[model samples]
Target chain A: MSEQQTVGFTVNGERHTVSVPTRELLVHTLRERLHLTGTHIGCDSSHCGACTVDLNGRSVKSCTVLTVQAQNAEVLTVEGLAGPDGLHPLQEGFREEHGLQCGFCTPGMLVRAYRFLQENPDPDEDQIRTGMAGNLCRCTGYQNIVKAIRYAAEKQTAGSV
Target chain B: MIPPSFAYRAPASLKEALALIDESGDDAKFLAGGHSLLPMMKFRVSEPAVLIDLGGVPELQGIREAGDRIHIGPMSTENEIIGSALLQQKCPLLPEVARWIADPQVRNRGTIGGDVAHGDPANDHPAVMLALEADFVLRSSQGERVVPANEFYFGTYFTAMEANEVLAEIRVPVLGPGTGYAYKKLKRKTGDFAIAAACVLLTLDRGICKRIAITLTNVGPTPLRASAAEQALTGKAIDDAAVENAAQLAMQICDPAEDLRGDKEYKTHMAGEMVRRAIRQALERAKEAK
Candidate 1:
C-alpha cells in the first residue's frame, strides 16, 4: 500500500499535473511519467550531478527532490534549454568544443552549465570550474567542458551586447 | 534508489504542521529542504511513516532583523543565506560558510535549519551556530521556546528538539562592529564532508580580545565547543602564541571517530590546525570590521 499525491508544476514554461507516489522522486517523474529522458539519473544518492535541473531558477539535483516538492514550482530540464529558433548557446558550445564523450553526463552538465552561465554571465575559468563543481563528468577531463561553458559565455555575452 | 513509502502532508500553515506532528507522534518527521532527510530516506536509514512537508508553509520562511538579532527562517535554503545581502553585511561568516557547503545544486535545496537540526557533526552549521552563539526557536502546540545552539545538539542524528515541534526560526545576534568570524573547514574534496573544521567568532577591543568562541566540527559525537580555548583567548592579544595555545587547548576536547577522512589522531591534529587558521583569519577580518 503506497500513498500517492497530485502535484502541479510548470516545466519548460508548460504546466504539468501528475499523480505520483509519495516517494516518487522528481527525476523519476521527469523521466518516467513526463517522458523527459534528457534528465539522466546517475547517482541516485544526489552526490553525482547527473540529475541536475533548474527548480524555480536554482539548480537542484532532481533525484534527491520529491516530485511533490515541485508543486507550483517552475522547473527547467535540459530539453528546455533550446528555443524554437535553434539550439541554446550551451548546446552549440558543447557541440563546438567537443565537450562530451560517452555522453552519459552531458545532459546534466549542459543543463547545469546553462543555469551557471545565467547566474554568472562572464565568469573566468576558475570561477566556472568552482561553479560547476557539483556536476561530474567521467569523460573529457573537464578541460573541454570548461571551454564549452566559456564558449557559451562568450557567445551569450556577445548576443546580449 | 526509491525511498520507503510514506504519507506526505503539505500543511498550509505552521500551526497545521505542528498539529499534524502532534497527531502523528514519533512516526512523523518534518520535511525541511529534503536534502538531508531525503538522502537518508533513499538509503533506508530512516523510514518515517508520516512526512509533514513544510513546503507550503510561508510562516517558516525568510531572513529578517528583529531589534538586536537577525532571524533566519527555518526554511531558508543555504543558497539563500549565501545570497542574502543583509546577512552578507551584518554577519558575513554565515555566507562564507554557506559557500563551502556541498555545491551549487545541494546548496540550492539544503536549508540551514535542516543542517543544524539534523545533528550531523559534519554538517558544518551546528559548529558555526555554536561559534556565533545563535539560538533556535522551536514551535509546538504548547507554544514556542528558544534553545541556545550550544545546548541544542545532543549526539549524532539527535537534538534537543521535541518530536512534536518544528524548528521555526534561528535567532542570531547581529554581529556588530569589532567582531571577527571565520569557519575553516578541512574537507577531502569540493563537496565532501569536513574531516575537521573550526569556527571562530571573536570580538576585539583595541588589540585585546573582548570575547571569543571556538567550536570544532566532525571531531566528536556532536559539535564540540572549545570552551577552554575560548577562555584562554578572552581578554588577551590574538598573537601567534595566543592562537597556538588556544588551538592546542581546542585539540584536547576532540573525541573524533576514525573515518575515511582520516584516523582519530589526524583529525585531532587537523582540528588544532583549522582552529589556528580560523582564529588568524578571524583576527584579520575583525581588524578590518568597522
Candidate 2:
C-alpha cells in the first residue's frame, strides 16, 4: 500500500492540482492526468530526450523526474509552445524547414530547442547540434531539424527586431 | 518504466532530511538531481521504500569560498557550476569537465554531489575529483565527516557513504598558481558514458613535472588513480619518452569490462590514448600558466 501525495504546479500558465502515487513520473502526470500528450516517452532512460520539458525555467527530462518533485514548480511542455497568436516560430519553422518525417522526436526537439534558443539566442551550427544532442531523431537524419531550429532562431530574432 | 511505489518527502531543511533518513534507515535514499538514481529505479536496479528529496534544502545549494578551499553545495547543478563565475575563475577544470558530461538539458539538472556520491566510475566527476584530490563532506544525524575522494569508492555502484548519511558538501582545494588540468573522455556518442576517460592535474616547474595526479574513468570497478603513472612523470621532464612511459603505466591499472563501447583490449588501449592526450594537454596548459 503506497501513499498518495497531492502536488500543485503551474503548467503552461495554468495552475493544476493532482493527487498521484509517489512513484508517478512527471511525464505520466502530464500525459495521463493533465492530458498533455505532447511530451512523449521514447527511452525510459534519460538517454532519449523525448520527454524533455521546461521545469522551473530550465529544460529537464520529465521521465526522469518524479511528479512529487515537481510540486510548486512551473512546467512548460510542447503544448505550451504557442500563444493566442497562432503557432510558435518553432512549429512554423518545422513546417517551413521540413524538420520531421515520422514526427515522434519533433515535440521533444521543439521543446528542447525552445529552451536552447533562449539559452543561446544566436547559436552557431555546432552550438545547435551540441545543445540538441540530448534529443535524438532517428528519422529525417537531423539535417532538416537543424535547419528548422536555425529557421526559428532567425525568425525569432527578426520578430524581436 | 514505473519505479516501485515509495513515500516521498521534500524536507525543508537538511536536519529534517537526515531525520527522515534515520527513521527510514537503509530503505531510504536521498534524491539529488535524480538523473542517476531515477534511471536505476526505472530499470528496477535500485528500490528504496522512501525517497528524501534534497532538492528543497537551501543549506545544500551554492558554491562558496572558505579559506583556501571552495565549498560546493550538494544540490548545485552542473549548469550552475558551468556558469559560476567564481568556479570558472578559480576552478575552470570542473566547468570544462561539466560541459562534457551530457548535453544542455542533463547539465541543467545533474549535480556534482550526486555524481560523486553515486560512486559510478563511468561518471566523469569521480575521476576529476580524484585527480583534484577533492574532499567530500558526508553528514548524518550523528555529525559531519570529511572523506577524501581517493578513499571513498569501494566498488562499482558503491561508496563509503552510509545509509543514514547525506553528502553535505564537496570541498575542493583552490588550485595554486602554476597548476594545469584537463579531462579527456572518449564516449561513443554525446551524453554516452565514457568508453575510457582520463583526468590529469599537474604542476610544472621550469618544464619539469613538479606534481601530477592521473585518474582513469570506466576502466575499472572504481575510478582508478594511476599513482605509478604519476610517479613516472613527477620530477621528470614531460618529454615524449616520459609521456609514453606514463601512458603505459596508466594502461597497467585498467581492468575494464567489455560492453557496447568496446572489448577489454580496445578499452585498455583507449585508456592509454586518453592518458596520453590528457597529459599532453595538461602540459601545454602548465606551460601557458608559467
Candidate 3:
C-alpha cells in the first residue's frame, strides 16, 4: 500500500503544501509536483550532486532525501539564488568564468557553492576544491568550476566590504 | 530510482519512536540520515514495510561530556561532529576520521549512528570505534544495554543490535594525555568507501610504546581489531623494524572480498601499507603531544 501525506515546505521563499507518496524523493517532488526544474537529478543515487539543494542552510542531495522529511523545511534551489536587484554573485561568477560546458551540473554547482560560501565566505583555492568536492562535473575537468567558485568568493567579499 | 511504497512514521520522541517500531514488528526500519538505507531501498535491495524516522526525536541529538566519557547522540551529523569544539579538544580522532567519510553533501546528512548501526564493513566508523574502544548504547521498550565495539559486529550486515533496539547513544572515553591517533583510508575518490583503511591509536611513554590499538576496515567480513599487530608494538621501542613487523601482522588477518577496489592480494597489501603509514604518523603525533 502506498502511504501519502501532506508535506508543507517553503521553496525559493514561497511556501508550498502538497500531498506526495511517502516514497517520493525530494528531487522528484520539486521537479515533478512543484515544476521547479532548476534542481536536476543526475545520479538518482547520492554519488552525483546534480540534485543538491540547500535544506535548513546546509546542502544535501535531494535525490536521496524523502519529501516527507522536508516537512516545514526551508529549501533553497537554484531559482532562489537571484534577487530582484540583480543575479546572485555565484550566477554572475559562473557566467564570467565559463564554469559550464553542458550546463547540466550548473544548478547543483551553484546551489552547493551558494551554501559553501556561507560556510566559508573567503575560501582559498584548496578550500574551494575540497568544499565543492561533493558536486561532480564531467565536463570542464573542474578547472573552470573551481575558478567560478573562487570568482564568486572574491566578488562576495568585495561587496560585503 | 525510487523506493518501494512504504508507510512513514515520524515520531517526535524516542519513546514514541520505540513504540512505533515495536508495534510495526520486524518489517519496520529505523531511518537515520537515510544515506545508506535510502540508496539500498531505491535499488530494491531492502523493502521495509514501515519507515520510522528518528529525525524528530529530540533525545537523539548533541555531543556532550558525561563524567569521564563523551556522549555522542546518534543523530549528530558528520559536519556537526567536524565542527564540534568539544570533540576536537577531547577526542580529536572522531572529528579527523569524520572528515574522510564522504563528501560535503553526504556528510551534512549522514549520522554517526547510521554509520555504526548499518553493519557495513566498508563503513569507516566501525574500525575507528574499535580502535578507540568505544561502546554503543542500545535502547528498547525492555531497557537499555551497552555493547562494546569489539563485540558488536558478527559478520557482514550483521551486528549485536537487536531488531527492536535503537542505538540511543555512543560512549567513547576521552583520550588521555600523550595519545596519538590516525585513520588512513585509501579510496578511489572523495565519496568512495575505503579499499583498505587502518585506524591506529597509540600512547608513548618516553621512547617506548605504552599502549596501542590497531584496527583495519573493509579487510574482513567485519571491522578487525589487529590484536596481534598491537602486541608487536606495545611496550617496545617503535623503530623501522617494529613498524614493519606490525604491518605484516596486520596484513595476516585480512580476508577482504575481491571486487572493483582490488583483488584479495592487493587489498591485503594495501591494508598493511595503511597500517604502516598510520603507525608512523601516529607515532609522530604521540611525540608531539605534551
Candidate 4:
C-alpha cells in the first residue's frame, strides 16, 4: 500500500519536485532525496528536536512530518542559514560563543534559533531557554547555546538599528 | 522506525475528507499534525493502511469568538492557540495551558483536537478541557454531533469520537470576571509528559469560593476530574485546611500507571501536591481577577 506521489516544495528559496512514498518523513526526503543532510535525526520519536526545520514560517520537527504532506510548502533548513554576505548572525554567534561541542545538535539548534528569533526578536535568557526547549544537546550543558542565542539576538537588534 | 506503507490523501475540504475516509474503509486513519499518530506508527503500534491528511481542510482552522463562547478549529496548532489574541483575552486558561504542552517544535504541529481525540491522559489538553468544561464538535458523513469534554473521553486512547468522525471544532465558554485558572504541571524536563499535573478553574464571590473545577492529568486511565476535591472547597473561604483537604480528595481518585516518571505512590502524591499548588495559585489569581 505504499503510494508514491510527486511532491513539489520550495526549500531555502530553491524549488524542488520529487516523487516520494507517502510514509517518507520530511527529514528523510531532505536528507536522502535532496541530499541536504544538514537535518539530523536524533530520537525517531517526536521528543527530540534534532530534526527541526522551518515549514511555512513555523519550526517543526521534520521527522514527524510526512514529505507528501508538505506539498507546495516552503521549507528552511540549517544549510540555508548563511547568505552571500557571510554566515548568518546565528551561525556567527554559534562560532563566536562556542555554542556546540559535539556539533550533532547544532543544525537543529541553529534552525530552531532562527525561527525563535523571528517569533521573539528581543527574548530574554528565560525566553531563549523556553523557546529552544524542544531541542536537546548532550554536550555543552546548554550554557553556550543560550549565550549564542543571546549573542545573535543582540547582533540582529544592533544591525537592524 | 519508519512507518509502514500507507496510501495518503490530502482532501481540500471537510466534505471531501469525510467522503475519502468513507471510501478508504475502517483501516484508514485521519492524520492531524502527525505528532501523536506518527510516533505510534514509527513504533508499529498503529499501522493504518490509508492516511487521510486533514491539513488542507479550510474549515478545520482558525480561532474565533461566537456569541458568548469561543470556537477553535480542531486543526489550530498549540502555537496558534498561544498566539490568538481572542483566546488570550477571553479564555486565558487555554493559552496558559497550551504553553505547558511539549515544546516549540512539537507545539507548532500538535493540534488541540488531536490531543483531545487521542484521549491520552498524559496529554495536557484533555485535563484543561475537562476543567474548562469545553465541548467538541464531531463531524462525519452522516451529520454533525456535539459532545462535551467530560463525556468525550472513555479510557486511554479511547474517545467518544467515532472512527468515521472528524473533530470539527472545540467550543469553550469565555471566562468571565472574577474567574481565575491555572494548569500546574510537574514533569521531569522540557517536552516530557507530566508526572502528575493539575488544572484548576476557580471563581470567588467576595472571599468565598463560588465555583471551582479541579482536574488531574496523567494520573489515571483518563483525565480525572477531582469532583470530591471541588466539592470540598465549593462554598468555603479557601484556607490551608481546605486546600489540604481538597488535595487529599484529589489524590484519592488518582490511579496513575507507574513508569519512568515515578511509582504509583509518588505519582498519586504528586497529583495531590499539584492540586494543592494549583488551587493556591488559582485562589490568588481569583482574588486578583476583575
Candidate 5:
C-alpha cells in the first residue's frame, strides 16, 4: 500500500524507519531493508511458516502481515532471540538435540518454538505438537524438535531454580 | 513475496476509514489485522491501489454480551474470542470453534470480523456463525445496518458488504436452555485448511430434538444449512436411526465440488460421517452443560 507516505516500527528493540509501499510485507521489510536475513521467506502464502516472528506479544506469520499494518508494533525476529555472546535456551536446545538437517526452516522454527515455550512453558508432547503445528518442518520428523522443547523446559526450570 | 506497490493509509477512526474507502472508491481495501487480505494482496489475487489500515480504529475491538445476544467487534482476534470470558460463559461454541482455527499463530493475527466480511465459504467461523444464526452489523459513511448471517454470504469471496462499508460487529444469539452444539472438521494437517467440516446446533426437549440446525463448510460457495436434515431431526428423538437419517439427508443436500482435498463422492460421504460424529458430540456437550 505505497500510496502516500512511509511508516516505521520497532523491530528486535530497534526502531526501524524504512520507506515501504503501503502493501509491503513485514517479512520482506525485515529481510530486505533491515538486512536481517535471518527471517527467511519460504512460502509467502501463510503456509510453510518460514517467516514466523513475534509481533507485539504473539507469534505470527510475517509474510501475511503488511509492513504498514505493523507500524508502531513490536516485532521480534529470529535475530532478536539472542543476547550478548550467548544463545537463547531454545537455540541451545535445538543445537544440542540436533534439531536441524537442511536448516531451511530453522529460523522460523526456532522463533516459533521460542514463543511456544513462552506461551506454554510446561507443555507436554501433544501440547508442543499442537502449539507448533502452524510451523512445519518437512526435513525432520520433529522427533528432535519435541525433544528440544523438552530439553529447554528442563533447563529453563533448573535455571530458575 | 512483496505485495504489489499500493498506497497505505492508517485511519484514526471508523469515520476516517470509511471516508478513505469512499474517496478511494473501489481502488481501496480495508486492512483489518491483514491475516486474510494481506496474503491475498501478496499473491496479487487482490491488488487494490490503496490499503486503509483499520488497526487504529479503536471502536472495532472487544466482545460484549447484552440481553440474549453476543456482540463481537470486527477487529477481535480469534485468540481474543477464545479468551473472552463473556463469550466463553454464554456462547461456548464460539471459543471451541476458535481453538481449531488455522493454527495458534494465525489465530493471533486473524480477526473474526475480517473472516466474516471476507466471505470465504471455506473458512470455519462463517459456517459456525451461520449455524448460530449470527447477525452482522455493517457500517459506512452513511450509517449502520444489520444483516443476518444467512443473507451475508453471496458467493466465493463475496458478501452483501458494499465497497465503502465496514463490518462493525457480529451479533450472535446466546443459546437458551436445551441447546447443544458441535463443530467437526477433517483437515490434512493441524494448520491446513479444512477438507470438509460440519457444524451442528440442536435444542432438545426431554432428549428429543425441539429444533436442529446443521451447516456444512468448505463444500459450496456459501456456508450451507441442511434444511432437510434439520427438519428430519426436529420433533424426533436423537436416536441412532434418527441421527443416521439426518446425516444421510444432510449429505444428500450437499453438492460438494471436487477439490484437492478429495473427490466429490469422498467429500460427500465425509460430510455425512462428520454430521453423525458432530451430532453425537454435540449431544454430549449439551448434556454436560445441563
Candidate 6:
C-alpha cells in the first residue's frame, strides 16, 4: 500500500484527477492509477522511449518524471492521438509506412513523433533520424521508422490524409 | 520499480527549498527534473532520506540574456536550451551541443544545472561550459558566490558546491565577434554517452587565431581542458593541419580508464578524432563572420 497525495493535470484534453505518492512516477500514475496502459514501459531507465508522453507541449520520459512534477501541467498520452474518425495522420502514416514490428515501442514512438512533427513539420530523412534517435525500437532497425516519419511529414504538408 | 520511500517537499520558493534542505541536512537530496537522481534511485544506488523537489522553484528555471552574458537558471532544462532562440543565435554552440546530449525525453527533464551540479566527467555540458568560460552562481542560506567552471569541478562526481548550497544560475559571456564554436562526440549509439567528446571555441582575426579554448569530455576523471591543444594554435591560421596537430595534442591530454563502453587506448584515440572533428565544425561556423 502507498500513501496518496492530491494530484491534478490535463490528460488528453480532459481534466483527470488522481492521487499518488510523492515518489510515484508519472509512468506508473498513467498505467496504474489512471489505467492508461497504452503507454508501454519497456525500460524505466529513460534509455528506451517507450513511455514517452507530451507534458506541457514537450516530449518527456514519463518513467523519469514524478506525477507531482506534472501537477497543473497539460499532458497528452498516446491514447489521445487518435481522432473521432480514426487514426491520426501519424498513426495512418505508421500503418501505411510500416513503422513497427513487435509493437511494444509504437505508442511511445507515435507520441514522440507527434511532438516532433509539430516542432519540425517538414524535416528530411536525416533530420528525422536525428530527431527520432531518442526513441529506440529493438525489433525494427529504424529504416521503417524513418519511412513512417517521412510519410507523416508528407501527409501533414499536403493537408490530405 | 518504485524509488525507495522518502519524505518529499515542493517548496514554492527557492528560499523554502534551501531551508528545507538545510533543515534536513545530509539526508536530503535536491530533485530537479530527476533525469540523474531518479535513475540512480531506481537502481538503488542512492536512496536519500528526503527529496527537496526543485520543480516548484521558478527561480531555478528559464534562460535569460543579460549584460553580454546568458544567465541560464540551474534548473533550465536541456530542451529549453535547445529551443531558446536567444542562446542559439548568440551562441549556436550550446544548442548544437545540447542536441547531442541525450534523447528527447531526457533532454526535456535533464537540466544544465543538474548536469553541472552532478559534475560527472561523462556529463557533456560541463566540458562545454569549460570551453565557454562559464561561471556558476551557487546559493545557500549564507549568500551567493560565483565559481568559475575550471575550479568548480574537483574530480569525478565531486564539485565545490556545499551541502547546503544550491546551484542557482549559470553565467556565460558571449564570444566576441569572429568567434567560432563546435562540439563533437563519438557514441556507440546516438543516445549513448560519449566515449570521448570535444568542445572547441575560438576567435580568428583575418584568418589568424587570436583566442582559443578546448575541452574534452568522458576521457578522464574530470572533464578536462586541453591546454596543450589550446597553446598549439595561438598565432597560426587554424587550418586542417593545425587542427590535426592540435587534435594530437588533445590525445596527449586524455587519461581514459578502461570500462564497459571502451578501452583506455581506444578512448584516447577517439578523443583526438573528436577534437579534429570539432575543430573542423568550428571552422565552418567561423566562416559566417564578416
Q: What is the TM-score of chain A alone in each candidate?
A: 0.98, 0.98, 0.98, 0.98, 0.95, 0.95
* Residue range B114-196, candidate 6, lDDT tens digits: 88889778988999989988999999988999999989989887899998899999999876667888888898886688999
Global lDDT of model 6: 0.88
Tens digits of lDDT, candidate 3, A1-161: 79889999999999999999999999999999999999998988888799999999999999999999999999999999999998999999999999999999999999999999999999988999999999899998998888888898999999899
Angstrom error of the Cα, residue A101, model 1: value is 1.4
Candidate 3 lDDT tens digits, B172-225 = 989986899999999999999999999999999888999999999999999999
Worst lDDT window (10 residues) for model 6 chain B?
B281-290
**Worst lDDT window (10 residues) for model 1 chain B?**
B281-290
lDDT of 5 by residue, A32-136 (tens): 889999988887788778899998889989888877677688999999988896998888999999988888889999889888888888899999988888888
How would you class the docking of model 1? high
**Residue-level lDDT for B118 in candidate 4:** 90
TM-score of 1: 0.98
Candidate 1 lDDT over residue span B199-222, tens digit each: 998889888999999999999999
> Once superposed on the true structure, which residue ranges of model 1 sit more than 4 Å away at CA?
none
Error of 5 at B277 (Å): 0.8
Instruction: Name the runs in model 4 displaced over 4 angstroms.
Output: none
Task: Give candidate 5 misplaced runs (Cα > 4 Å).
Answer: A1-4
Per-residue lDDT of candidate 5, residues B27-83 (tens digit): 888888787787677678998887888888988987888889988888999999999
Give the candidates in order of lDDT, highest first: 3, 4, 2, 1, 6, 5
lDDT of each: 0.92, 0.92, 0.95, 0.93, 0.86, 0.88
Per-prediction DockQ scores? Answer: 0.88, 0.86, 0.93, 0.88, 0.71, 0.62
Cα lDDT tens digits for candidate 4, B10-122: 89999999999999998999999889899899999999999999889999999999999999999999999999999999999999989988999999999988988997889
Best by DockQ: 3
Give the per-residue lDDT digits (tens) of candidate 4, residues A1-161: 57899999999999999999888999999999999999999997877789999999999999999999899999999999999999999999999999999899999999999999999999999999999999999999999999999999999999999
Candidate 2, which segments miss by more than 4 Å at Cα? none
The residue-level lDDT of candidate 1 at B77 comes to 91
